[model samples]
Target: MNLHGWIIYNGNLPGNKFLDFAQWIQAAATRKNSTTTIYKNNELLSYLGIGQLEVLRQDKNKLPDYVVFADKDIYLAKQLEYLGVPVFNSAEAIDISDDKIATYQRLAVKNLPIPRTIIAPKIFVSGQLDKTTVQLAMESLGFPMIIKESFGSFGEQVYLIYTEEELYKMVESLQGKAFMFQEFISSSYGNDLRLQVVGDEVVAAMKRSASDDFRANVTAGGTMTAYKPTQQEEKLAIAATQAIGADFAGIDLLFGPNNSPIVCEINSNAHIRNMFDCTNINVADYIIGYILNRLN
Candidate 1:
């Protein structure tokens, strides 16, 4: 059986951490008696002769059983799908999971409680930002709201707005970008859960808190501590991951008023950090194993 894992990225490998993960996968696959491939070209297919690349133009007689696209680009994922290789989580699923608005809408429709959200157009028309419309949305869901660009990762584009003035400033600053505005949930415990899901199962989970900052992402200097998941939180994490049809994911969950658990966001291509120390699960190995399982 032949299985190929593709590391598609836009630039130089971000850090040694990525390379470390790749090395771990390499070792794991070797032990399993499987072949693994890494394609590191970041330039566009046309610029770099993607037609000549084995992934783009597969050898009809030697097609790979599974292909994993690790890049943040959706276009490349779609191109691979067109070539008939069964990609993990497929291009369509990646496209949906990457967008914040779509992620919330899909989860909410499934009866999964998500914070109240509103999507504003990329370029606001003359009447698009009527005061009454904004007021009504804010009335039911009050201050200290969150606003985020449609596609961002590692807590880079998330914003916390506390007052009307700040909201206007944010809207004006982000006038020409796709954004999602939502009410913020103040966790009574002052921490949020990070659940890593692999193919419909919650493999590793942790609680992260930025005691000094509002964002709970470790990249933003948050402290990641071991968290024990309640039976309900574990089930919710699995359901949310499956709802988006993600084979491997990082689901952000929060506890709102009355201790109601809510899903904040679903992540594609999640980086595993502090996960191994807390859970000792070898999340990267599990992710690679899932891909191999589908191929077998």
Candidate 2:
């Protein structure tokens, strides 16, 4: 495959993890005989006008056949798409995956198994929180529920509220930000399944458990173990990936009643390093292969 591609990640984030993702994808592309260039999101200036769309990239390095978008910069990704470059996972997928409210809405529209959720209305300031909304969610989800901001990663913005006061405080504090109230799945306390799906198949998976936290994200001090997903798990994960219109994704599943699988979340740009460390599976290879095949 003599394909040329670009791997783009966020440059402002103060971590090598984003670069690691871009580099991993680059190496995988290289092994397949594809040439790739890694660029930060800030490197390319997206310009838009009436009947015009272009990025102020260097004239020497032309755009590639495709782009491996590893950042949450949906606007930049959409600009690339507008210029007719096929972007794996696509901008729309990333946009939906980045918003928990949108993710749940997509999942619910598919009639997928998700925890009962109520979206908090977005208010402009800190003091404008509607207690009626809180009352409704409290009545619906009950105590010890979960409150998650619509846009957060690694379990940092998720809260487990055991009382109405904490719930109100948390919800009010997230002014101007989208968030939701969810019924906590007690059966899956401290643990969940992360299935890496490439295209239409589940390629790798691991069980993540935290000793002291409700979230099972690896970035939140969660431990991992290789997991063999049940047929139900694989099917649900694949359906979720498709539901979000992603070429590939990492689907988090919570164990529901009687060990049933519930959709916890879907990560469009999920880092593969942790999954690889746990399962020794290089999901980048699968992603590159999938993109090449799609391009072909």
lDDT of 2 by residue, 1-296 (tens): 48899999999999799999999999999989999999999999999889877888775588899999999999999999989999987999999999989999999999999999998876765557777888999988898999988998887888899998888778767888888899999999999999999999999999999999888888989999999999999999999999999999999999999999999999999999999999999999999999999999
Backbone clash pairs for candidate 2 read none
What are the lDDT figures for the candidates, one per model? 0.73, 0.93
* Tens digit per residue, CA lDDT, model 1, 1-296: 65555544445756765555555656666676667665553543522354543333333334555566666567667666666777766776787788888888889888998888887755644334656656775676688888888888877888888898888778777766788778888762347889888886788888888777777888778878777788888888888887887888888888887766799888876767568876777777787788788777
Checking candidate 1 for backbone clashes, the offending pairs are none
Clashes of each: 0, 0
| Estimated TM-score for each candidate | 0.87, 0.97
Scored against the true structure, residue 41 in model 2 reaches a CA lDDT of: 95
